[model samples]
Target: MNLVPLDLDRDLELLHAWVTHPRSHFWGLQGADPQRVRAEYERIAADPHHHAWLGLDDDGTPLFLAETYDPAHSELAEHYPVRPGDLGMHVLVAPPTRQRSGVTSAVMRAVMDFCFAQPGVDRVVVEPDVRNEAIARKNAEVGFVEERHVTLRDKVARLSFCTRTAYAMSAPHLQPAAIAYAHRRLIAKAIAEFSHERLIEPIAEGTGRYRVGDLAFTARRYALNHWVVDADSLTGPLDALDFIAGLRETLGIPEKLLGTYLEEISATLAGTAWKVTHRRESAAELVHADFQTIEAAMTEGHPGFVANNGRIGFGLQDHEAFAPEAGRPVRLRWVAVRKDESLFVTAGDEREHYLAELGEPTLARYERQLRGHGLDPDDYRYLPVHPWQWEHKVTVTFAPDVARRSIVPLDEGPDRYRAQQSIRTFFNVDRPERHYVKTAIAVQNMGFLRGLSPKYMQATPPINEWVRQLVDGDEELRACGFGVLRELASIGYTGDAYHRTGTPGAYTKMLAALWRESPVPRLAAGERLATMASLLHRDRDGNALVSALIAASGRSAAEWVAAYFRAYLRPIVHCLLRHDLAFMPHGENLILVLENHVPRRVFMKDIGEEVAVMNDQPLPAEVERIRIDVTDEIKELALFTDVFDGFLRHLAGILASDGVLPEREFWALAGDCVRAHAKDHPELTGRLDLLRPTFKHSCLNRLQLRNTLQMVDLTDQAGSLIFAGELENPIAVFG
Candidate 1:
């Protein structure tokens, strides 16, 4: 039985059917005609707390009138804590099919699911006529824990109330969180596999506590300012930000610099919003909406490497096949490179969000749909996924860790040794000879170089047909998925330094594809959570929850990450930057190192949560592993601006003295970052406000802001000189 919100406009029709039936009471509209029943339903619908809906059997036949309400909304506000979050519930099962044993029971389950889903709902109560002892007893069969006869709803009726715990008792009927997690896990996997992947699913949904299938993630999503928090530490919402602010102040950094830092961080967070979504009916919605459209866009023709299993390897496409500029550099791409210039794959952005809009039901339905989809009824996975939530997906990649001896050899120069940070990227289905294209420039800080981060592809053309054949009827995707993984192990991309064990990136991409399919903002109260980090509060239970999360993450990978930071990264930062490298450059572009082929051991946490904090409170245990979040792009840009001016000058000085770097190669590394950013993002047009005459030298180009970056260069005519020649005898102004 599906008990969702009632369409008041159609209530009278259902009421007429019920009243004319064999068992229903006056609810069937006997004394009051159909019009009167419709009028009453409309009246209740007008109020937020009162609602009426028809219960539908599995076959879509309307079985009963399932109505519910808050006693507080019925002139009984004084009886409850109407402090906004609190809610009270009342359920009335009206019928032609009154005591059909299982009908009412099923309807009651549906109502319970709805009640528990109201955000911050504390308790739900149902009022039945005190004389209806039969219903009072039936409530127990339907899983009502605290059923009692009491006055409620401004009426002298026996009332039944249920807490979250009571609602959880129907766990067997709800969808398991593992399903939602599988979706999220796949999203992260797709991001690793595909290009320009964003929105790794949250480690946990925005519940009061932790969730299952929450893989290796340190940052958590609990309220920060809980009254029950212990005084020994100020760890919660603003813990990371507050720590960074205090660190800067204690170190006595000039506010002039701090202002820019704060502004950039704020803007980045504001621009790149984090999001979370859990669709209970996503599978059905996809089927109804034809999700296969995405598959067609990504992989129609390419039959990737045929494995020993006899199935052609297939991967997701970056875009549509008929798309313009088929090989244009995009976040992700599918290509068959006959030669360097012949690389091609059906490619284009799949419009997934639009489809989602057409398929998704209202929030009230989402809860029922989710629960209905799950095997367990009490599982909160049935709850709507939190939209626009903060999450961090850390990518671990490392090349051979360079000891000091190794570093000394690379330096092969004066006390000042130089290393550049470069990024190597690729998309799905490649050949043996295609090594990562080395970018033209590098950052002065070796610490900022990223060797590996979560990356993968193959969302389209779902797993090989052979795997589908071998994995079998029930194990189709799962068995095939595990089998291919073993093959990946053979190729050195699934274990240890060569690879790591985790969900395939295809899952992550499919999720993003799903999000893109439904991009509209369907939020309650129209709040899209405008900021990446919003300040929230929790009670004692919430505080304990946060503490537990912190302790868990801290004990897991957090300590290992922290230790890695100290071992290889810390000394290099201090020894290299005698000028005092601010914040260890780990916001976005600032955190990276090559240990194996993967970029591993990055420590970027505890920065910029509290803007006005003035204490030395210890950092929260949650601030451990950090990665490129929504704000990483802009924050990293800010980090880039911080070091560009000084670092470029140093590079020019050394290159000039050594005279080994080609003129073009020398200038290549100078402003390559900003240049690449400009070329990639056309939206920043007219935003480049470079310093006047700062256009000639890459040094000044590096210091400009997005709103102020001019992409022009400047040089001091008399002092300026390019490689292979000197300036004119007269004053040569740089421009």
Candidate 2:
């Protein structure tokens, strides 16, 4: 059903007939005429506190009348204390047209859905007449909890309310459907990723069916490149812990990693449950939303990593407020660090310039906070801290710094920031032009303690500035719109008293922050930005964001793929072969610049840590820290493993599964991009060709499977990779 804003002029007569009927006597409009209905609806349309909607069936026939109002401003004001998210609503279906069995119930559900769709509406308040037994029974069916009788303008009413959670439970279709969808998707990922990691060897039992560990543990082909583990294969219910326990011996996961991994898996499952329960938008609706909305709507966390959302320190409440999936804007907690114990670096701007961006009022307030503690504001540098870190880590773990007055906690900053897919990094939503603030939070997620190392902060701006200079000087890169959201400034608080070892530990990293330039200010007039991760996104309804983009671009899938390669893949290839440079160019690390939903350019981020100079290449003295000495044989996996197998392989599978493009065509396009880049730089032919053959498959899950607590060594990120037997490159066929 489509909800049309109540047309007071056109709907007056129809609305009068329905509300004045004996069935709608509780509505208190029984004796109302057309003029009276018009006056009432006109007043509703005029009032900001109230709204009326007409629900129409598929054939454009009016089926129901719904009214949504602010409980605080409406007739219910004095009767009850209105909550922040409470919205008053009433529903009346068109009188008995041959009384279909479930039609009334369905209409009620639709009305409630329409009401809850409005932002800030967490609960719906309804005050049906106390005498209306039928309406009361119908309300209870949808999870309404009756409180007490209350006197309204015209009649005594039963005050009832239905929370979002209550409605999700009472409305069976949503929870069951979401659970089935989430479970199927998660199971498919576990089977595929675990299999790829060689954690479980599956023997083919029959067509599209395979058995793993035991004959009873079986799975069938699921999506384009994944599998669905059968529920019946499990000894009992489909619990992730139980499933892992069953396969522990076969997979050879250590006792230490296994227990930590289970905690991660449990957290992942909990996140999925929250997402499924809270989601209201359909895939189509999400497709039409703005970039950030589409980003927040992405429910499938990662295509390959099964325990992708293991925010270990986050409980349910913390997850709801801080997780990127939660989509809630957060205010960052601020702190002042003494100058002697802190290091502040910037691209060109001074600390004062960055502070000015926080607005004069916020700057004054921060200064006042420092002065209140009898400290000079000039002697300290200000840094934003994650609220969770302040509550859990900084307060307890770094108590010495707090006690000595080296690190003084300040007030919350003015801007509302949104947690990007990388949880610690925050986008300034309150002022989009402001730089992104990346803070250190001592939390374990996706196999790493996600704390920013204070040691790395010294070289952060220099590394980014070097990359910016290279891109600016290169004609090809400049022409292709290759850009970086520079980590313009960084600050790390190193309290010597806290870490006696002189090496930065978890506690030392707890108070550091870096600010990167926002991509929003750099966007051209016609261009919009979306995270490249959206390419692999499939909504809860299994609709693809990439497919939607392709449709909106009005280009053939192959044409769109070619354009995307030219903009995204070609740049990475050029950098690797021509400059001996490699980036951790995974999906989340790249931002897609789209012009009318078509790929226009690319913005690479997370560069302070992920960008590296490969093959012992000499860089300038200041930026030489980025250089990593890897053998020539292992160098090419930068493109082959990270670009192809890491991201595009899964993308190709999804596009193929959705019938947007054939799997072969997708790789062929990728191969064509590499060939074109090689032909353009004939001097680098030998270097490029050496990387074309089959390479050892890089197993992402293997890293986490081996050590979920700390997946990779921060000191040597590349050395932490786990590799299995080689797989023939799909693009090799194109050559």
Question: Quick one: best TM-score, which candidate?
Answer: 2
Candidate 1: lDDT of 452? Answer: 16
Candidate 1 regions off by >4 Å? 1-9, 19-22, 26-30, 46-49, 55-60, 75-84, 90-102, 131-134, 141-143, 151-156, 172-735
lDDT of 1 by residue, 441-529 (tens): 11111111111111221211121222223223322123111111100000001212223334433212111111111111222232121
Clashing pairs in 2: 447-711
Q: Give Cα-based local distance difference scores for all models.
A: 0.29, 0.78
Q: What TM-score would you give candidate 2 relative to the actual structure?
A: 0.81
Q: What C-alpha lDDT does candidate 1 achieve relative to the native structure?
A: 0.29
Tens-place lDDT per residue, model 2, 77-96, is 89899999999988889997
Q: Candidate 2 — which residues are off by over 4 angstroms?
A: 1-177, 211-237
